[model samples]
Target: MKKLVILGAGTAGTMMLNKLYKVLDREEWELTIVDQYKTHYYQPGFLFIPFGIYKKDDVIKPKSNFFPPGTNVIFSPIDRIVAKENKVLLEGGKVLNYDYLIVATGTETRPSETEGLKDKLWYKDIFDFYTIEGALELHKRFKDWEGGDLVMCIPELPYKCPVAPLEFVFLADDYFTKKGIRDKVNIKYVTLMSGAFTKPVASKMLGELLAEKNIEVIPDFYLSSVDNDEKKIVSYDEREIPFDILTIVPVNMGSDMIERSGLGDDMNYIPTNKHTLQSDAFENIFVIGDAANIPTSKAGSVAHFAAEILTENLLSAIEGRPLDAKFDGHANCYIETGQGKGALIDFNYETEPLPGTFPLPGIGPFGLLKNTKINHYGKVMFRWIYWHILLKGRELPIEADMSMAGKYRV
Candidate 1:
């Protein structure tokens, strides 16, 4: 029997496993998934924890719960991948050879990458919402705290859920206002990007929203280090921004195993055919989610859409057909602008986010680029959809490829 091994078992890995299991012939293929952690985190929900919208229980579940019954699930750390030999070396010296490999070992926040980021102020005045611990700890710090300069900083790019920092400041505005301390809390959004977002239209809309919320945006500030002693963040050009409480989206990097295997770039992200989701180095090896250096938002929606395309391409490769299915770098993001209002954006490669209704023209329950309570509801309802429909590889109402039906270029 041939082996089909999937690494990581995170959102991308688990979804791929379920998608392939139904299609691959059981008699000819042996399915397996490997990961270091036993718990699966709904990473998108991590942003809500600091604001008390979601709790620990809501974002976590046993990894075993999602795997199919016959799957050979291995909860062990990966040492490295011997790509040339088509074998994976686990920590205990055990080896698993695969006929095909899916590298879904997602990206991670590296606080250590920045100087003084994990120093004395860490988990005290400085916290990241990327991790469960950081989010929960920030929640505790926010509970009884008198407000001051609430700094939400993005040190670098390619972070998971790019809109999260914006959401953080937006929710902070609502959170403090409800606590009767909106005036006391001076919220600031600091980022490496020139505007509020990568896309021009969305950035204008979000930047205007920030201004209306009385939050300041400091753009193009490349973070050098955190001055824990003086309680300030210093930029590379010697600009310093003082903070009372620093909530940061730390530098994100792909798994070290990618580096160990010599299959990744400088940041450890696997160089992939963005249109095909196949590793540029190895034809039998595919990459998905944050692991691949795909020029799109490292959001769950991107993974979901890419998974559909990947499933088709992998099957074609198995049957010796041309891998013709293409992933258009499709990404759909829901931005929570706080106070029961949110905005949605959908686009793919060669297209920027546009203003219009989503899924249907002039008849969407959720509006694109327009803030509405229904958009907020769409986000709220997505958590359920993620667990039930998305992770389970069930077909969603939206198509894998992006459509130009409702969107209008401005």
Candidate 2:
């Protein structure tokens, strides 16, 4: 039997495993999934953890529990991928050969890439909401924080959940207001980007929201070093931003194995065919989700949409057919604006986020580019959908391609 090996049991890999497992002829193929960890984290929930919306118990589960019956799972760290030999070497010298390989090894934060980011100030006055540990630490620290000049910054772009840092500051604004110390606390936002987000229209809307909340913005400030002793972030242009507590999204990178294998771009993301999900270097290998250097938001929505296309293309490849499925970089997300209200944005490679309804023309229970309580409910209900439907590889009602039916090109 031919072998199919998938690396990383995260959202994309897990979903792909289930989707492909049900389609591939079991009589003719064998499948194996490898990951370094046993637990699967609902990463989106990491955003709400610092605000105490979700507890630790709510966001993590065993990776094996999501797999289908008759699937092979190996829990071990990988050493490197020997692409020349089409083999993967495990940390302990174990090797696995594959007729097909899928790399879904997602992006992760590397705070050490920044000077003094992981020093003594880490988890004390400095924290991140991207990881479970960082969020939990910030939660504990915020309990006693009097909050003076709380500065949050993004060191670089291409970070996972691009809008998350903005979400954090917004939630912090509401969080402090409810605590009755809103006047005593000064909330400030710092970013390397010129605005609140990457998209122009969305950024303007979000930037206005920041203004409405009375939060100051430090735009276009590139970080050079963190002076933890003085609690300030220094920029290459010699600009210094002082803070009482600093929250930062550090530089994100792909799996180190990709770098070691000599199969990645400078940032270690796989060079993938943007529309087809095929690897640029190898015919039999595919890259999906945050691991692929696609010009799209590295959010879970992008992965879910791409999976629908990738599965079809993979099946075609296995049958010696041309890959016809196209991934249009479709990504949609619920942006929580605090006060039990949220906004939704839908767009793809060819289109930016437009002011419109979603999925149905003028018939959305959910609103777009507009904040409402119903959208917030959709955001909360998504956690349930993620565990039950998304991880199971069930087809969602939404289409893989971006729909312009409900959009107004304003």
Candidate 2 local lDDT, 1-410, one digit each (tens) = 89999999999999999999999998888999999999999999998888788999999999988999999899999888887788999999999999999999999889999998999999999998889999999999888887688998988879999878888888999999999898887888899898888889988888899999988888999999999989999998999999999999989999898899898998889999999999998988999899999999999999999999999999999999999999999999999889999889999999998888876888898888888898899999999999999989999999999998899977
Clash counts for all predictions: 0, 0
Off by over 4 Å in 1: none
Q: TM-scores of all models? A: 0.99, 0.99
Relative to the true structure, candidate 1 reaches a TM of: 0.99
> Which tens-of-lDDT digit does each residue in 1-410 have in candidate 1?
99999999999999999999999999999999999999999998998998899999999999888888799999999999999999999999999999999999999999999999999999999999999999999999999889889999999888999888998899899999999999999999999999999989989999999999999999999999999999999999999999999999989999999999999999999999998898998999999999999899899999999999999999999999999999998899898889999999999988988989988998987789999999999989999999988898889989999988888888
C-alpha-based local distance difference test score of model 1 = 0.94
